[model samples]
Target: MQRNTLGNTGLEVGPLCIGTSTLAGFTETYGYDVDDERAVETVLAVFDSEVNYLDTGNNYGKDGLAERRVGEAIRRRGGLPEGFVLQTKVDADPVTGDYSGARVRRSLEESLERLGVDHLPVLALHDPEFMSADQDGFGPGGALEALVAIRDEGIADHLAVASGSVEVTQRYLDTGAFDVVLNHNRFTLLNREAQDLFEGARDKGLGVLNAAPYGGGMLVKGPAQQPKYCYGERDEAFAASALAMAEACEAAGVPLAAAALQFSTRSPLVDSTVVGISRPERIRETLALLAVEIPPALWVELESLRPDARI
Candidate 1:
C-alpha cells in the first residue's frame, strides 16, 4: 500500500485505516463480541501491517474499552510506530448526555489515558449532528468550541468532523475549524449521499475519510445472509439491490467484498478508507481484498446496478 499526505496535517497515511468500534465489543451493533485478548491481538496485527492509521472513539465500548485495548498493544510494543497516526473522536457523556466544552476536554483526557498517549495526531468531535441547537455541540461552550481550544493548546495536532449527515458535515466544514472530514455508510456502493460533502472537503484542502464501504455488512456478507444496510433494516428494494450486486460480482468472478472495498479505496475523493477488524485474520484478508484484480467491466456493472435512490 502506498502512503499519501493527509491533507495539510503533514502526516503520511496509507489508503486504509483500522476502525475500532467493533473491536470495543459493540455486540448490539455488530452482533458479535470481541474479547479483550482478541481486541488487543488485532491492534498488534495492525501495528505489524503496512497501514499506519487508526481510528477509535471515546465511547466505543462500555467504558472506552477499545482504546484501552489499543493502549495495551502499544504498551507491549513500547510505543507507537515511528510515524503512526492515531485519531479518536470525542463523545458526549454517556450518563448525562453532556457535550459542553468542559465535557469535551474531559472526554479527550479520558481517551488519552485509555490509549496511553499524552497527545493525539487528530481529534474529532464525533456525531455532533445528533444534538439540537445551542446544546451538546456547535453552540456556546459546546464541544466544537472546546475542540478548537484543544488544538490550540497543542493537545491535538489537528481537528476533524466525523458525522453521518452530509449537510451537517458541510456546515461544520464551513466553520473552517476542521482539518479533516469523515463520513461513514453514506459513500459506500449503495449510497452516494456524501458525494457533494466529499467534493467540498476536497476543494477546501481538508482530508476526506470514507468509512464503512461494506454498508455495515450487506455487500460483503451477501444480502441473503446479512439482510441489512448499515445495520439498519432498509426497504425491500434496498435489499434487492444488494442481492443483485452480490450476484453480479459472482458472475464476474470477483468477491463482493473486493468491489465494495475498492469502491471507496479507488475513489479520488478519499484519502483513506476505514475498515473495522475484530480478528487477526481480518488483517490479512483486508490486505488481500485490496490486492484483488478487479476487472473494469465489473465496476461498470456495479455502477449500473446502483440503487435508483440512495440508501
Candidate 2:
C-alpha cells in the first residue's frame, strides 16, 4: 500500500500496479481467460488493497473491451479513489501493424471513449518494437505530436512508451517527451538488458514501470520445459539455472510469484511493478505477499541464483 511518486509526472502511485492485459483478451498469449466479472472483482480487490493504479491498453481486445471493463468496475463502485490513477497503452493499427501519428491519435480517442473517461492519467505506446520503423512517429508532426496535443487538451496527463528492447526504450527516452517507461523482459533474472534502460529512465526522471517481472510466467513456473520464445527455449543449462533460482526461493521460504513481484520493486530504478491477474483470489495472494517483507539474507540468496552467477 506504499505510494511512490512516478518520476516527475507529479502523480503518486502504489508500488504494485494492476495490469489488465489478460482481461483485454491477451490471455491466450499468456495462457489465461477474459472473464469480465472476475476481472472487475480483481480490480475492486486491488482498490480495496489500496493499489489504485490500473494499467490497460487499447489493442488489448477486439476494440476497447478491456478499458470498458475497467471503467465499468470503477463506475460500479460509485467512483474511483480521490487520487486513483488509470493508465493505458495506445497501439498502432492492429491489422497493418503500423504505428503512425494518425494511428496514435485514433487509438487515444477510441480508448477514451471505451473507458468512458475524458482523459487518462497516463498513456503509453503499447509496443516499442512495433514502432521501430516509425520512430519518427514520435517526432514532430508524428505520434508524439498527437500525444502532446492530447495532454495539452486535457485528454491525457502524461505520455510514456512501453518497450521490450533497451534500444527501442532509449529512442523514446531521448525524445524528452515521455513521462514514464514500461519495460518488459529486461529486468528479469533471465534477462537484465532492461537494467541499463532502467538506469537511463531514472537519470532522466522518467517513471519506470517494470512489466513481465516473472518473464511471462517462465520464472514463476521455472522456465518452460518446452522451447518456444527466447525465454521458453532455454537449454538444459538455462533450465538448471532457473530451477536453481526457484530452489533458492523455496529454501528461503519465498514463493516464486512473491519473489518476482518483490524483486522488481526492490530496485531503485523501478517505481512500480505491474502484475496481471485473472482471478480475484490472485489479487489477495499478491497483497498478502506484498505485506510480508523479504529478509535481506534471502534477497542475497535470490540474487546469487541469477543466470550469470550460475555459469
Candidate 3:
C-alpha cells in the first residue's frame, strides 16, 4: 500500500490501483459481467483498503454505466476520504467517433454528471486511435486543447492519454501536453514493446501508469483458462509461449499473477500499476499477489518469454 509520486504532477498514488471496468455488467469491450451490488462492494472494498487511486472511464460500459456505479459507491460511503484520487477518461463519441475539443468538453460534462462530481483529479483522453491521428484530435482546438482548459479551470487537476497502441500513445506523450501516459496490455511480463515509449515518457518528465499488468487477464488466469492475449484470441505460438510461462511459474513456486504484477510495479518506467477487478474477493486476491515475492532466477527465465507486440 506504499505510495509513489506520479512524475511531475505531484499526485501521490499507490503502486497498485483498482480499475473499475468490470464494475459495469457484460460488455463487448471487456467481455466481463458483474452485477450492481457486487460492483459496488468491490469498489468499496478497494476504498477501505490502503489503496487510494481508482481508475474508470466514460465508455467502460454501454452508455457509461460504470461511472454511475462508481458514483453510487461514493454516495454509499457518504463521501470520499481526503487525499483519495478518482481518475476517469473522456472517450470518443459513440456515434460520431469525434475527439474534437468540443467533444472533449461534452464528455467531461457528462462524466461529471454521472459521477456526481464537479471536478476530477485526473482526466485522460481514452483510445485516440479511433480518431484522426494528426489533425482532428491533436491539432488546434483538439482534444488536448480542451483537456488543458479543463485543468486550468480547476475542473481536472491532471490530463493524460491512455491508448492501446504504443505509437499513438508515444505521439501524445511527446507533445508534452499530458501530465501522465497510460498504456495497457503492454509492459507486462509477457510484452516489452512499451519499453521504448516508457523510456521516452520518463525523459520528458511525464508520469507513467502501466495498466493491464495481467495482460488482459491471461497472466492471472493462465493460457489454459484464458486463451486470449490483449483483446484477441491468442495464436498458436503465443498460446504455447504463455503456457510455458505458466509452467515456469508453477515450477518456481510463484503465481503467474504475482510475477506479472510485480514485474510491472518493479520497473522504473512505471509509476503505478493498474489492475481491474469485479468482486470483493478479487481485490483481496490482487493484494495477496502484490505481497507475494518472486525469485530473481524466475525473472531471468521470464526475460526469454516476452511477447512481441505492446498490445
Candidate 4:
C-alpha cells in the first residue's frame, strides 16, 4: 500500500484506515457482536498488513471498549508498528452530556488510557452537533480551546473535526484549529453531500477521510439485504438506483462492494477511506475488492445512477 501525505500533519498514511466501531461489539448498530478475542486479532492483522491507519472513538462502545481492544493488540505487539497512524475522537459525557473544556481534556486522557498510549497522532471532536449551542464546546474554556491546548501540550500531535453534519464540522473548521476533517456516510456512491466540504478541505491543506463507502451496507449488501441508506430510513429514489447498480454489477461480473469501496479510495480529494471491519478475513476480502477491476462501461452506468447532483 502506498502512503501519502495527510494534508499538513506531516504524517504518512495508507489510503485505507481500519475502523473499530464494529470491533467494539456495537451490535445494535452494525447488527453483529465482536468478542474481545476477535477484535484484538483483527487489529493485530491490521498492524501487520500494508495499511498503516486505524481510527477509533471514545464513545464507540460501552465505556470505551473499542479503544481498550485496540490497546490490547498494541500491548501484545509490544508497540505500534513503525509509521502506523492511529487516531481517536472525544465525545460528550455519556451520562451527564457534558462537553465542556474539562470534559474534553479528560476525554483525551481517557482515550489515551484506554488505548494504552501516551500520545495520539490525531484527536478529533466528534459530533459537535449534539452539543448545545451554549454547551461550552466552542468559546474560551470550551472543547475547542481544550483540544488546542492538548495539541499545544504535545499530547496530541494534530487535531481533527469529525462529525456527521457538514455545517457543524465547518463551524469547527472555520476556527482554523484542525489539521484533518473526517465525515462518514456522506461522500459515498449514493451521497455526495460532503463532496464540496472535502474539496474545500483539501484546498486548505487539511486531510480528508471519507467513511462508510457502502452507505451503511446498502450498496454492498444490496437494498434487499441492507434496506437502509446511511443507517436510516431508506431514500426511495436512492434505493431504486442502488438496485439498478447492483444489477449492472452482476452483469459486469463485479461485486457491488468493489465499486463502493473503490469509489472513495479512487477519489482525488480524499486522503483516506475509513472501513469498519470485525473479522480478519474481512481484510483479505477488502484487499481482493481493491484488486477487482471495474470496466469503463460499468463506471459509466454507475455514474449515470449516482446522485444526479450532490444532494
- What C-alpha lDDT do the candidate models reach, one value each? 0.88, 0.78, 0.84, 0.89
Q: Which residue runs of candidate 4 sit more than 4 Å off their true CA positions?
A: 307-311
What tens-digit string does per-residue lDDT give for candidate 4 at 185-273? Answer: 99987788999999899989999988888887788778887777876776777788888888889999999999999999989998899
TM-score of each: 0.96, 0.90, 0.95, 0.96
TM-score of 1: 0.96
Candidate 1: 10-residue stretch with minimal lDDT: 130-139
Q: What TM-score would you give candidate 3 relative to the actual structure? A: 0.95
Off by more than 4 A, model 3: 26-31, 132-135, 307-311
Model 2 steric clash total: 1
Best by lDDT: 4
lDDT (0-100) at residue 58 of candidate 1? 94
Candidate 1, clashing residue pairs?
none
lDDT per residue, candidate 1, 121-205, as tens digits?
9999888887646484667787788999899999999999998988888888899899999999999888899999999888988
Give lDDT for model 2: 0.78
Which whole-number lDDT from 0 to 100 does residue 194 have in model 4? 96
